[model samples]
Target: MSSDEVTDVIDPRPARRLDVPFQGFVVDMVSDEVDLGEAGGIVRREYVDHPGAVVVVALNEDGDVLLLRQYRHPVGAFLWEAPAGLLDLDGEDPHVAAARELAEEADMNAASWDVLLDLLPTPGGSNEAVRVYLARDLTPVPDDERHTREAEEADMVVVPVPLEEAAALALAGRLHNAATIAGVLAAAIGRASAWETLRPVDSPWEYRKN
Candidate 1:
């Protein structure tokens, strides 16, 4: 079999030049022209230029995972999802960002954190990558420390489901959010292995670096 027939963990892409076709408040549509070496020739592709994000799978001592139900306008549905937020602030650590999202979105904090998974939900269309975190030893934020809610978050609802049940929901397609599905399933699998698959919170994210 040729080398191209075998899938590898890392596939080095060709060189490319990028230009933005449309810029939104939070994201931009970018077009790139790739140099596919002398044999393949050049090709153009367009995709969303995302800022990346962190997702938190906050697990309680009772083995329940915290979730948020908020209206996602793009999907036109109120979906149950893990707490997540973008890495909008320049130079902000992803771990810190994940912690902040847990507090702001779920009014909770965790004493232990581990990297559960990293994923590109729409690799064919967008450069958006998300790191899912497993947070345990949970505690609620103080009333005064809670972030003021606005927009869709103003009506956001928090729910706690057993970790196994959440995994079932993901398999049944009841949980529509990408991060929540991936996080729940990954957490379930990791727990079965006594979390040996977990990575340190500070572990480098190669997708973000690229």
Candidate 2:
């Protein structure tokens, strides 16, 4: 099958957003006004329209997963998370973005990449979504090739946790980041399948343009 065809996804019909009134870095605020025809009532709901992103689950030979500790001003905490980045670059593949972030944040490279899971973390309030990639066969980039860190990332800490411990932290609620929690659990499931269950790194991203 082609990369654009996702056999696992069943979608005969889907809703498409028609109105976008605002856009910003934090979130693209939008208002959807609706009418209740029965009683002639009207309603408006405001929400965030995200550009989506990718998260990487980088694992080594011993099954240790690379994680990052970075301070987020909004949450007022230095949270532990898998390396991830926004899909801000036009025409960039999600898998490529994931690999770029893993290198930038962890100074490592992966020879194998697969889509572990796709999640809409907060569908009730936002169209923000994340695609988690499982990356293995790790290698470290040469020091000269590593990207320079800035801003919050300048103080970021890279830590590798055993797969079991990482899963525990995610399941027990210690891993507060949404992508990290989902990625760890998804990796656990992928391990059970001997990694055969994972989708191709370039699997169809039906929601990328939504």
Candidate with maximal lDDT: 1
TM-score of each: 0.92, 0.85
- The lDDT of each candidate is 0.90, 0.86
lDDT of 1 by residue, 114-168 (tens): 9998988898898888999999999999998899999999989999999999999
Q: Which ten residues in a row have the lowest lDDT in candidate 1?
A: 7-16
Off by over 4 Å in 1: 1-18
TM-score, prediction 2: 0.85
- For 147-191, candidate 2 gives per-residue lDDT tens digits of 999999998899999988999998887889988988998898889
Candidate 2 clashes between residue pairs 3 or more apart in a chain or in different chains: none
Highest-TM-score candidate: 1
Task: Judge candidate 2 against the unseen true structure and give its global Cα lDDT, from 0 to 1.
Answer: 0.86
- What's the count of clashing pairs in each model shown? 0, 0
